[model samples]
Target: MSRVRLLFLSLVFLVAGSVQADVVNKNVDTAVDISTQLVKIAHKVTVENVGKTPVKSLIFGVPAHIKERLSFISAKVGEHQLRLSETKVDNQEGGFWKLELRSDITAGRTLPLSIDLVLGRGLIPHPSQITQKEKQLVLFEGNAYYFSPYLTEKQTLTVNLGTSSVESFARVQPVSQSDTKITYGPYEKVAPFKEERLNIHYENNSPFLTITKLERVIEVSHWGNIAVEETIDMEHQGATLKGPFSRYEYQRETQSGIASVKSFRTALPASAVDVYYRDDIGNISTSHMRVLSDSVELELRPRFPLFGGWKTHYTLGYNVPSYEYLFNQGDQFVLKMRLMDHVVDDMYVEELTTKIILPEGCHSIELTAPYSVKRLKDTLHQTYLDTKGRPVVSVSKSNLVENHIDDFELRYTFAKVLMFQEPLLVIFAFFALFLLVIIYVRLDFSITDEEENSRVEREQKDK
Candidate 1:
């Protein structure tokens, strides 16, 4: 053959070989339903060489979103199993590739790829076992898709929801297709599997309240006392009342059925004394207190049952004796106290102002917080004969969830001399003023003598 003919033949062979090497057998299995909180996706890819010559390697690509929830469960190619490693290919979010078989593929060979993925709404994993009695499970209804040019074949997706029968209205739609069709369970009446209920009904009796404004002032007086005041604007997020609520009906229902809305139960530290819970107008008489040696528990029964979207504001104050939170470390004084407790739900702390009043001569004011703070502002607050003024720290956090409460800590330091400086200044100032008044009176002429002399002088002048 001529050199030109040989070159053309070589080119044709190379093109054919590349096409054969790129061919892959792909299988995708996907399961999704509202009954389960999550969707499971499994993919298997197999590569086989039908050409006469052996190919060196094969490259497999997966969708970006697919990799987020989907993990490589296992993979195998021929007798040698392939180990899968993830690598970013492009700047695109979900761009990744799996490299297999770096060497040439022998004639009539096959390589397999297997991967298992668990996909869901967010990074937080859905609860595995949801109890029906808890009434906390929410069905997750969403769509998922798989795309690959290598796998031109379409596979049917299967979804099963254990014992609970699939709702006849449940619909499934393919990503590429706009039309959706309702389908029944593939299997007939089978044994109900012990699966967590996707829908649950439970007693949610806890009142959901938010503390719109919280002002905690720690005033260190020369006289030993730390005062803590909390103002809370609480609201109820329970089932609303339809039409008018009848007292007779309510009482009957209370006797027969369980209450859906949560009630208020506030627990204070054992050392907490002089606890009080009052509403905007005045004290709520329904509240009761139980004090034990270890801790104090206050039961605050609102005047009315809090339903969904109903709001009530209340103020609570308690004074902790000086020795409880204030401690003497060598010459320095340390004041430590618990700010708030967990258990409180929907706690939207719009503004938290904390004033730490140190003794008059105390120095070196430092503040630290244990919890992650959204925003914080600090300033000096002078009040009540304070020479250098007290340091006030303000923290503001928005859209705060419940879990963040456990991680919060606030710490600060101040000089110990203020412990005595404030008291001495107040006492000496009052005493000095009293003595000055007495001395001025004694130096002046007597009141009676002055009055008599003035009268006699007036008589002589008149004569």
Candidate 2:
């Protein structure tokens, strides 16, 4: 792998060096935490412009083999998100990303950057096969240092393992090492296109969970509620259970770590209420809910404990006061919410879709996200009393990570005149119904009792 194989397992970041240093990478601190199913790597760095020219962009590289598992590649300058572009990796199977710094970095100015990456293939069973009775020891391999096209004045790498039963480690000269962690030091003036090898085997038997698909729909009702619904397709991608699982044996074997999913929890806004959870089969009863300080927590249990190579599908929904996500900017309506605010930890999402349904008569709908979307569609959706249908905006993407939780802003022109349209239509409908009933009751459609009696008497006299 070239210097920057930090993402997709094959991110060949090849940046040509300049004779004179125009941009200086002062310090880079990379932390790789392997405690969860998905690997979380965070890079905090300080960059400065040393030369007379301004720097426009920087290249980031990632691994190639597991590109499908990688997601939520994002950067931040303080609280603001930095814009980036996707690029094809040269001679590498991974992904290459270029972050554009629109402002010219003047000679002496400095910039602080926070980069976060998620690796879907972080922890896999090393042998790729494990028996029911044996302890799982998985091999984790990666570059010892951050691969960069540019030289760094200082750099560091820290590896955090899941448990202490780690052995058969292959390592280079690291300043410090431990049973559950390793550190490679504060190296000085590093050359580009250099690779450091890391191969270690550790024992971890947690359920390797991945969400194959997630669909979240947000509906805004000016009348009262902000309704949110989510449909999920979840899978346990960990080591397959070899034989028929014995519950009695599982209960008896407490010491051995087994990979299975018993339950999961999620957080909702503080004001959320009327929570509902269900699956394709029916309502899931093995769930609980409660209210915390500023949020509601929902603990959900699947129909059964999920073993490796098994899957479950479910849906959940709740409602909150509209005042929470909607605000008024004079005549315009501004709605703010996350694409996906709550999810399981170490999550690997294969696909994510977010749909926002606005009021019936909203016009000039403007929707924005922090990053680009794989697909976006604007259409009309018919609902109760909506004559013209509500405006629907759907955003979909693939290869999602939990950290993709960014606030999405939607602005639309909502006239006060249209706010009462549905209510008025409903009231008119009821009045029409009552009028029909009154008219039917008063109209003389048949002969009265006296007429019937006179007709009977005439028929008897004629006989």
Candidate 3:
């Protein structure tokens, strides 16, 4: 009986293998943008089911070398987006994402997909260290083919260097180099899990500002105001500083610190008011703000220039009307706000924790995030006039990119009468104090009554 059961299981595994092998990549065209600190890759893939069975999903893979740096990945079919989930790929060693297609691909049918991937810490500083006056050079190592689980029939890879000064790149045959772009291949018939070293050495001077940690707090008020504050710890993740720093040379030389970061513009909501930026030392006046039609551009300059490997910390806060983000129906309330906002262009946040402090007396709270996050334990926050304290909802996520700038919905139940609780408490306290004052002044505190004492004094004087 044991031998018969083993044979049946083996047959089932073989049949599943054949079904998975039916899906193949008809063509994959990849475009890699290496213009900034982040590597952005877009793949236009056409897949086909060659066997008699319909294909229900497709598998995408990243090389093991770059797997840990993967920050964001998304897929779309025309205007609609597809769902993706992480799964284990048997016999493979790398990161894999399984994308579920809207409709199954029938035998001999093809389906097109658009996949975008963003990777942080992808580029390497070739020299690893640089002086204040030296221009920065970096190296990019990647695969020449679209790393996937299925066999690809035809594919081409394009790399945009963003600068005409090209040091060198990989040549994997049928390669052509234009001014700032490199074309790799129209390669034919590639096997699964194949990797060819594609390296590019070039000059990139983009700001490598990385927010090491961010704590965002959103305080909701039932009195028509919402307050937001963000505490940010930032560091320059570019090349290391080579030698002693000279403030004189940096100020005198026009070409000094090309790779150093002087300032970066942060975009806030147009409705943001009373915006302020400060560090531990106090208000930082080196910044400027310009209110645009749609956003308020705040140019933040630290106390000093940020050299490679340098670090800084600061706090930014602003206020917005509650009506813009808070909505209510009877006793139920909802708050829709961005989980994270634009810190900078192509920003990378290593750790992010967002806390939403709802009004007191709120209950049955729930949160809806655009992506998966680690929901922390609910806590109570005590502020002025709070009786039982306000409910605080916190969620954390790591390895975040600017793609995470999306809205989160927080729903809770709040009684309409609770809005007047604080005001009524204040009013009654004042009224009770005035009543005590009236009794204290009008009544005699001594052992005798004032009117009776006056009458006895007059009788004694007349006698």
- Per lDDT, the best of the predicted structures is 3
Q: What is the lDDT of residue 289 in candidate 2?
A: 90
Q: Using lDDT as the measure, what is the rank order of every candidate, best first?
A: 3, 2, 1
In candidate 2, what residue range of length 10 has the lowest lDDT sum? 3-12
Give the top-scoring candidate (TM-score).
Answer: 3
Compared with the true structure, all predictions reach lDDT values of: 0.47, 0.76, 0.89
> Can you give the TM-score per candidate against the true fold?
0.51, 0.85, 0.91
Give the alpha carbon lDDT tens digit for every residue of 1-463 in model 3.
2323433433343334522766677899999999999999999999887778888887788998778789999999898899998877766677888889899999989899999999988899878999989988999998998787676778999999889888888879999999989998898767677899899999998998899999999999988999999999999888988998889999999889989998999999999999999999999999999999999999999999998899999999999999999998999888999999998888999999999999899999989999999999999999888889999999999999998899999999999889899999999999999999999999867656778899999999999
Query: Residue 134 of candidate 1: its Cα lDDT?
Result: 26
Candidate 1 vs candidate 3: which has greater lDDT?
Answer: 3
* Residues 1-463, model 2: lDDT tens digits: 3222222121223333422235556798988888777788899988766656777777666655435556667788888878877875445456668787756667777788899888877677765655556566677777676665555667888888767787666656655777777788877665544566678788877668788999999999988799999999999887766767676766678743366778887888889888899998888889989999988988889987777778999999989899878998766998999888676766778889999999888888888786778547688899888888998999998776777777988989989888889889999999999999999999989889999999999999999
Clashing pairs in 3: none
- Regions of model 1 farther than 4 Å from truth: 1-206, 210-225, 239-262, 292-294, 321-339, 343-363, 407-413, 440-463
In lDDT terms, how accurate is model 3? 0.89
